[model samples]
Target chain A: MLLLAVKGITESNRKFLSQYDVTVVTPDTITAQQIPEIVISYAWDDAIGQKILANPNSKLKWIQTQSAGVDYLPLKKLKDFGVVVTNASGLKAIPIAQTVLSYILYFARGLNIYASRTHWEPYTNQYLVTELPVLVFGTGRIGQQIASHIRAFGGTVYGVNTTGHMVDGFDEVYSMHDYQKALAKSRVVVDGLPGTPETDDFFNNHFFDQVNQLFLFINIGRGTTLNQNDLLAAIDDSRVKYAALDVTTPEPLPKNHPLFDRPQVLLTQHTSWGEYVNAGRTGGLFRLFEKNVPSFVKSGTIQYNIVNLDKGY
Target chain B: MLLLAVKGITESNRKFLSQYDVTVVTPDTITAQQIPEIVISYAWDDAIGQKILANPNSKLKWIQTQSAGVDYLPLKKLKDFGVVVTNASGLKAIPIAQTVLSYILYFARGLNIYASRTHWEPYTNQYLVTELPVLVFGTGRIGQQIASHIRAFGGTVYGVNTTGHMVDGFDEVYSMHDYQKALAKSRVVVDGLPGTPETDDFFNNHFFDQVNQLFLFINIGRGTTLNQNDLLAAIDDSRVKYAALDVTTPEPLPKNHPLFDRPQVLLTQHTSWGEYVNAGRTGGLFRLFEKNVPSFVKSGTIQYNIVNLDKGY
Candidate 1:
């Protein structure tokens, strides 16, 4: 079997993969005729992916993504090609959830204002996470991890998903139709929803209007899901007290954009998942790949994080 | 009974105290002749406190302070005068702990760098709190609260106090002499110690030299306990990775001070306890005062948060 491993696989990980009785090729060394049966990638190489799908003799069976969200991939084409997709979903949950809490605390503890002070200027508008109820959209692995962290801080967690079925870490679960009730009670709203046709522009003016109180809004999910203008409007009207956006529309959101000038917004440049990339010899991403590889080699199937391409998550 | 209630008592709290047949006098209304039997203050008025103590006929029986640390109060004089001193110890724990977590996450998640970026510049040096073990000095109410919050995030908490006695929230407890072992293994160190003669300059060059790894330092404790030059030296040598000081020796830390210019340091002034002050009509300070009032009226001693003058905590 042949595997195309991209850059970022550590030295030890490369050594660990050598015992699999498979030929591993890097992007720099691979030729057009050498389309591998399997590929491990982070940022999807559209040119290479298309070439593999185009060749009738291509043996591309599965793709292992190094990111929790696979929104940047050509999902419809991959689904049609019957290419099995497994994501690094639960791998980034710990750090991503920690970053979500960081955003919430940054605002709740007044670091959004205090961190910029050159002289001692005490701020009084600070709040405790325990004092505010949090409403998180998407009760998946990322959201559940976030819910657990919030619960640890004594904050009420209201998880939102397609169905209102209860999740383990959430105090209460709300369906998409009923999350507005949770919104009314929450002073913090976190978007952990994946990017899909349904989720695109989901958090527009109508969504922000449902909030009964001034709330802290955080987006660690997907940039395409947010309507940037609507967020700005929400801030201007005092509906959203502050926003900490880890993902923003058209990231590298042009320097002169109005979002950069807004003191109430904190832009993190979509780096939540960057923490564990080079943390140690054995990071969660490599461990996850190691776990999926054995099953894939035995039966051409992955045991975990199998993304349902048709539904787009 | 007469109670000198300084500024910041809400109208509702005043009404609650009025039902007990106690006359509440503000600083402006209280004359030298009308020294009350009890006083509720936040920033201790030395003039009023001294005058009440010197007057042999004065009925100053107890002092209710609205802060966790009563270090600013003349502990020796209060002990000599035989007046009971009760502080609002646990009242600020939740918000202050939240602030402490805020400081930790601010650096761990790379907000200290990313927050200032006008353009999209993703940072890779981000970390998770769960990846680091924390060593917190002073395992009292505030330290315990911080421990619980860190535990919730799956981080290990090693607490320190006068004795190596076991504490509920900490994974391990160490005495002042034995904390060096915990410090060696920790990547985060927090000072929640009280300001006293023994604690003054306690976290100096000798203490910073004991750390085995590059660490994040946070001080939510009294500023006098830290030696600023030692902290700066630690930062210079890269032993201290980052620092967040909520308290400084001579605050308002001057605008031209070197501490203000250091990108690695985050100065929050001293507003961790300021959150719940004006939050609602029934804030924690008023509630603490209300809890202590009935006990003080019935007996000369208070029920909770009685300060140990000799220990100065």
Candidate 2:
């Protein structure tokens, strides 16, 4: 019997999992004695999850993460134990892409300024989408999805990756070492890189300075890659016209944080990945399960979106 | 010498007009004495314009209007006087389309609510642009252009016109009499109709009630086409989710109006048809002048966007 862990498992979810001989468990009902029986875990980042994964006799042959990033989880421990880690990455691609498009449209169409004004003084800064160029950092699932949406809307997109590899939906690609060349032409910069030690503080003052034009910054990735102080300074210097941060240096930024009060900044409160209706996040999790559970049952392995332990995506 | 009427005509503008040996005139400088000698008038909606148009000895052969709609002008008198009226229509299509798109994207990505929240609880009503259905009223130049932009962004559009004749960029077309069928499936309703006796207050209580589901209303057309009280009632009844209006009944809305304070309504202050930069409106007017002036010089007729005195558009 496969021991699966989850949260708020409903009757419909149970009906979906009834095809296999599996026993579902939750944090409140689980105990240390049951750790050795758990063959798969679908939840993480909680105190109970850490204790469960810490078991020496844990039978976790595979783990499915319901989130896109896995940097915070025990990557080393999972690799050492010979367990395969898979993530639900592409599931949130379109939703997050929609959010990114909103930011670009908000600025390009002058809605950012129009919504605040009380008079009939029309803005002169509006431009067609085809006129602006956008640069996206990290040509991964999220970045590629964002690029595709931008392309569909008649905008130009340049992508940044480790090796400058070509990707669908991007007009051009540049390696991280030579990304400044791309930044010079982009009017909007998007950060979609994952959180890793090597990427920490990657978007420093030097990175912001390479942007020669007034631009909008959209950060939908892990917050560790950006230096908040430098971002504030860039905004102050007028190098950045505005910014929309779905993720920040710290979660639940203090009530008096300056970023919350700025007209040029929009704080989205990190809810890009979760939706309260239409089974948004939960629906994606189930889709990942449907694709992986069948493979894991027969070969003790999962096929889709398996995170590279070394890269920590 | 050609007599021209304008507002704030700059030195650069005079340079453009100097090429044709034209005398530029504003409302303050013009008089009935020059009306008989005038062969063209380029300004409207002022005391001087009325005087010139009313001039019994007016030698006016053609009037190049600086606006899209000709309903407010003396169309019957111009028709009787045998003066051709050409308008600057296509000039503002892209900007107004951008404004309409801003409203759609704002709702699709939940930026409408996300930008207002005081805490970290993100909104979940978000959906991709490609998934929503948009219904456009009046399949004229602006409507077709807005529909095309929505199509480029992957959304489906249904157009409502007088005859329901097929138009590009729309998945289907519905006649004005049958517009209710289109509204039933639309997640967004775009009003691009002109201000005419037949169109005034057409989008009244009955029209808003046809919207079975919660949706956004974008009015980039003439404000006279909508009834404000019914719109406010629809919002109060929870049938309309949100609204973005670039035009209103009065030129400058009262400072303490309720629409200004509504959380669901965004007043863009009649700016969609004008842009601040790119010499936006003036640039369009000049292009219209260049096209018409050469044609008028060759023949006594204008070659572009000649308004029908009977249709009044």
Per-model TM-score versus the true fold: 0.92, 0.91
Q: What is the lDDT of residue A173 in candidate 2?
A: 98
The lDDT values for all models are: 0.81, 0.78
Q: In the order shown, what is each candidate's alpha-carbon RMSD?
A: 2.8, 3.0
Q: Across residues B80-149, which tens digit of lDDT does each residue of candidate 2 receive? A: 8888888878987877887788888787777877776665565665677766789999888889888887
Number of clashes in model 1? Answer: 0
Put down candidate 1 lDDT per residue, A1-313, tens digits, no spaces: 7777764666777777777766677777788668645444433567777778777656777787877788888888787777778887888888889999999889878888877777766777777787778989999999999998998887899999998999898998999888877887888888999998989999999988876446689999999889999999999989888898889889778878898888899988888765644653225666777787776777777788888998878
Error of 1 at B83 (Å): 0.9
- In candidate 2 the C-alpha lDDT for residue B258 amounts to 74
Worst 10 contiguous positions by lDDT, candidate 1 chain B: B274-283
Q: Name every residue pair that clashes in candidate 1.
A: none
Native-to-model Cα distance after best TM-score fit, residue A135 in candidate 2, in Å:
1.2
Q: Write the per-residue lDDT of candidate 1 for residues B1-313, one digit (tens) a residue.
A: 7777664677887787778777777677777668645444433577777777777666666777767788888888778767778887888888889999998888888888877877766777777787778999999899999999998888899999888999998999999988888887888999999988989999999998887445689999999999999999999888788989999979877768999888898888888765643553226666776777776666655788888999877
Q: Is the docking of candidate 1 incorrect, acceptable, medium or high quality?
A: medium
